[model samples]
Target: MNLTQQISEDMKTAMRAADTKRRDAIRLLQAAIKQREVDERIQLDDAAVVGVIEKMLKQRRDSIVQFEAAHRHDLADAEKYEVSVLQAYMPQALSDAEIEEAVSEAISIAGAKGQQDMGRVMAQLKSSLSGRADMGKVSSLVKTKLIG
Candidate 1:
């Protein structure tokens, strides 16, 4: 089943099981998806749905970091829960080694030799690695490869 259909089915299960947290998270996801569809005036494919999920996960990660830094462990934990739920829909994340390999390949493909080429390298990396790796880690790996 497509992501949207799968999510809809899961939402029904969550409701039947009385899983409030899961149900709420699923509703939030549906809202985000619906909002995007309405704004864009187009139906989102599975890839686009994945993009929305990734965007939500990224936002949660940022919120978790900020909350933790501000000594709001409770808020941070809540955001982490949302992140976990959202992650269930994401593609399997790349390992560090895999990210490094992908970065190496991207650098070579972009002919990125130094800091000046960082932008081009990063652009390619974002396109290739979106939803597959943590971009912050990828950026550091690219810098190391380019500078070393």
Candidate 2:
């Protein structure tokens, strides 16, 4: 089944199991997916679905940080729970070693000589690394490799 179908099935499972948190988290995800589809007028493939999940994860992480800074542990915990639920549908995360290797390869392929070519290297890395790696981490690694 596609990612969308899998999410639907999980939502049903969550409802049947009386998992309100899980169900709500998934409903939020589904709503986001549907919104994007409606906005773009295109069906999102698995890769696109993964992109949505990644976006939600980023948002939740930011919210958690802000909530903690304001001493709102309860709100932070809720965001953390959503993050965990969203992460379940993501592709397996790349190891540091693998990410390093991919970054190196992208640099070579893009003919990136220094910081000036950062965009080229990132463009090369983005497609292959998007769902499997954190782009923020990959970008920092690229910058370090280029500068050093």
Candidate 3:
């Protein structure tokens, strides 16, 4: 099944099992996906769905940090639980070694020479690394590789 169909199935499962937390998390995700589709006036494929998931994950991580800093463990824990639920749909994360190798290959493929070529290199990497690797970390690696 496609990601959307899979999400729908999971949502049904969550509801049937009386998993309010999971169900609520999935509802939020579905809302985000639907909002994006409405705003863009286009149907999102699996890749776009993954993009939405990543965006939500980033938001939750930020909230977790802020909540913890404010000594709000309860809120932070809730955000963490949401993160766990959202992560179930993400593609398998790339290992550090694999990410490094992919970055290196992307750099070479883009013929990136120095810092100025970072954008080209990143654009190349984004397509291959999206959902599987953290772009921020990949960017830093690209900078280090290009500078050194």
Candidate 4:
């Protein structure tokens, strides 16, 4: 089944299980996917769905960071819960070792010489690493490999 169909079934399961937090998160996700489709007038494949989920998770992570910095643990905890819910839909995350290997490969392929070539290296790695690894972490990895 497609991601949309799987999400529909998961929503129903969440509802039946009375998991309000998960159910609400899933609803918000579905709404975002629908909005993107309507805005672009295109059908989203699994990769697109993963992209949407990743965007939401990034937002939640930012929120959590800001809230914690502001000494608002309550709000940060809420964002963390949503983060966990969203992560369930994503593929297994890449390990640090795996991310490093990919970064090295991208740098070599792009013939990146130094930090100036970050854009080239990142462009090459984006699609291959998306949803599997965090770009912020990947960027640091690329920078480390390129600078030395």
Among the numbered candidates, top lDDT falls to: 3
lDDT of 1 at 136: 83
Clash count, candidate 1: 0
Give lDDT tens digits, candidate 1, residues 42-92. Answer: 999988998999889889988999999999999998888888888998888
Order of quality (TM-score): 3, 2, 4, 1
Model 4: how far residue 104 lies from native, Å:
1.2
lDDT of 4 by residue, 1-148 (tens): 8889999999999999999988998999999999999999999999999999999999999999999999999999988998988898898888988988888888889988989999999999999999999898898888778777
TM-score of each: 0.90, 0.98, 0.99, 0.92
**Candidate 3: worst-modelled 10 consecutive residues by lDDT:** 103-112
Q: What lDDT, from 0 to 1, does candidate 1 have? A: 0.91
What value does the lDDT take at residue 136 in candidate 4? Answer: 89
**Model 3: residues with Cα > 4 Å off, grouped in runs:** none
Which candidate ranks first by TM-score, i.e. highest? 3
Between prediction 2 and prediction 3, which has the larger lDDT?
Answer: 3
Q: Which ranges of candidate 4 are over 4 A from the true structure?
A: none
- Taking the tens digit of each residue's C-alpha lDDT, what string does model 2 give over 1-148? 9999999999999999999999999999999999999999999999999999999999999999999999999999999999999999999999999999999999998888999999999999999999899899999999999999
Pairs of residues clashing in candidate 3: none
Q: Between the candidate structures 1 and 3, which one is better when assessed by TM-score?
A: 3
Reference-based TM-score, model 3: 0.99
Each prediction's Cα lDDT score? 0.91, 0.96, 0.97, 0.92
